[model samples]
Target: MPAESRTAFSFNNSINPSTFILIGIPGLEEIHIWISIPLCSMYILTLVGNCTILFIITTEQSFHKPMYLFLSMLSIIDLIASTSTMPKILCLFWFNSREINFDACLVQMFFIHSFSIMESTVLLAMAFDRYIAICNPLRYTSILTNPRIAKIGMIAIIRGSVLMTPCPFLIKRLSYCGTNVISHTYCEHMAIVKIACTDTTINRAYGLFVALVVIGLDVLFITLSYFMIVRTVLSLSSKEARVKAFGTCGSHICVILISYVPALFSFFTHRFGQNVAPQVHIILANIYLFIPPMVNPIVYGVKTKEICHRVLRIFYQKH
Candidate 1:
């Protein structure tokens, strides 16, 4: 019994696992290069799209409102979340490189989880902005000023980090006995924990707590905001005004559903989809997490006239 093996829950009580092996798409090793091609395309698209949105919002005068400010925040989060895991996946798929250092896994888990939580929070903030604009137009400007939006962004980051900080340490405390192999493309919290040869009740409980309490609350508030928005929209006297207001929220609504539906589906499949294959679950989870980074900007660029005009102008000027 060494000093380091004194965890609250220990099974093997042996030495530390120096490295963990990452796995993806079981039984598809031979065609991984082919898989990497499409994945690389998606990753590139995610980066370029999010960066373009950020660029447009930062440089354009008309895009500096609260909605676009939150869009910028989301772009930043999407970039971090997508990049945090994609490079590792590319290596795993293209180069057959699966060995990741213990500390590196911790860092990856931290960034992936933190940004994910932050993105969800930002969506919640965006919902609040929409609610204010539609339901309480007079107070919207005062409530969601640049400074206030900045504070909200900062709070989202801080809250996400503070909650996810403990996850890695919890896994680090456990003794990994044999086969430090994680059955996922990247260092997800539960995927890494499954390799631990110790009682993982607390780890599982904490992860569930964050998912249910922190993220679930965000979903609840977003729903409430939209509910109030619809109520207010219906109350408006002019049909054209109502149509215009709903149209303004159309992109955000689509983005919200796109982000949440897949996420909630993948989450439930992981936890309770008894007959689903692990590969299918992993693919759904990856899509849930990564597609938004690529799709969100496109939705905004197409739905938002100002953003679309600026984007096309930039392209024309470049060409």
Candidate 2:
């Protein structure tokens, strides 16, 4: 909160320059080091786990199918999303270095939200993949070919990039007017927008719109996909067939829950949780970003037999 902590440039029309101070957690600065311990461990685990998944998917010819390709995409997004925020978070916690430039903050915000959208899109794609493989196995090979998967991946990237492109520009138009301390660890969208002294109605509306479009529509479609999948699965004559169908979806379901549950909690709390503690919001925000990346690979690695075998085979060979 000190003048020395902020590096603001003079603007001509009396607008406050864009600079922010990120207090890791508002009332818990004393335990930042303690907080960093588990966060750092999660980040390390995220890196190692996602990287291993990527390595296995890339190196193994057996993993060239649509499912594994989509898994690889998820791993990549998790890596980028967690990396975008975690290092700065660690810096804030470990070294008490919390000054982030406006442009830098915008870039961070862009990546965080963009990758979040990307992850959701990827999950939706995976749901579609599951729906196809379960409901229409005969067309599975013909439908999700490598080229079609590549297009889906490309569309996911472009959709996220295009939708989130306006966010930073919209934030740039707001007048900070010297109120620029963000309570959260990272440059979250609403967190940054809330500090602006000018009217943030447009920003708020657009933010909500984006959330509804990306998260809302995607969740709906994913649910619909699963609904059809379950219907088709139930209609299968043999119990073993039904069991196998459900078994294949277990890991994706787990990943989807971890990805969305914390995210929705943080999203709603940020806007609606007036009685909620600030620390709780901040902690859950970080958890939503960190937990998915850390858990996705573990979920898949354990649930997917091929990955488990290949991982064990590598360790066995190394040993």
Candidate 3:
């Protein structure tokens, strides 16, 4: 490859900061305009949707149960997750399309990862809630009472924040001698860490470990929760009870699958499938981050009839 191409390729590894303006994907710069419009619209809608969910669950007497409480927590996480990156991303498509300072980049990466970890943990909690409701209905109230639920939610948020703090701090310590252009829309941990001038052995290893610990543990717990849920549902005496239980969990399962499957695909592909097409990477990247927020409210509203009716009532009242 020519020197320019080589420079672009090695930008991630170089520690010396040469002043060069970062530009996004070629032939797709104009496309970002269109992308931004929809993204901004979606971000607004996500905020509104999630906020509505939270308000409904909090204020409604009917939604005082454990299930809606968990749903409210999930909505809060989704709102934060989407907010962490989408605003910066949309800004990049507009006036602030140039250099992102190293410090700002690190900040973005930290929140993005932190919120993602929180989202996963919240999903795991949701799974456990489902398991309790289905398998031990008599004790579901006692098991996931307000105090216990609040404690678990706090633990999830704190764990995610503490675990992801090191990633940005590690990235900050590394030298950036080369080009600073990040390939993707956001300052992702791996994408940013890969550019360090020093030996990123520790960073990469720690990142891999964090990814496995967070994603793996969440997946495992979610799977186990569902396994128990399925067993309980199957053992139910009436088909109606089984259907109701499954129906209650359907939105959660859909949201979980949508959020995690793409993430796993991106994770593995980034490691082992480097040679894959940039388009594939871009598509998966967008889907992994963006789609979940867009669909979360839809899933909840569709699968949970009460939330749906409440959301509709809110809309009607607004107009």
Estimated TM-score for each candidate:
0.94, 0.96, 0.90
Better of 2 and 3 by TM-score: 2
lDDT of 3: 0.78
Tell me which residue pairs clash in candidate 1. Answer: none
Who is ahead in TM-score, 1 or 3?
A: 1
Query: What tens digits encode model 2's per-residue C-alpha lDDT throughout 1-319?
Result: 4542334333323355646888889989999999999999999999999999999999989899999999999999999999889999999999888888889999999999999999999999999999999999999999999999999999999999999999989998888775567889999999988878889999999999999998899999999999999999999999999999999999999999999999999989988998999999988998888999999999999999999999999999999
Minimal lDDT window, size 10, model 2:
4-13
Please, what are the lDDT tens digits per residue for candidate 1 over residues 1-319? 5222232124244446667777777767678899888889988988899899999888889788999999999999998888889999999998778878889989999998888889889999999999999998899889999889999999999999999999988888887875576778888888877777789899989988999966699899998998899999999999999999999899999898889898889778877887998888888878887888889999999999989999999999999
Off by over 4 Å in 3: 1-22, 317-319
Better of 1 and 3 by lDDT: 1
lDDT of each: 0.86, 0.91, 0.78
In model 2, the clashing pairs are: none
At residue 128, candidate 3 shows an lDDT of: 86
Clashes of 1: 0
Candidate 3 C-alpha lDDT tens digits along 167-263: 8667767787765666677777777766566788989899889889989989998988888888888988999988888888899999999999999
- Model 1 earns a TM-score of 0.94
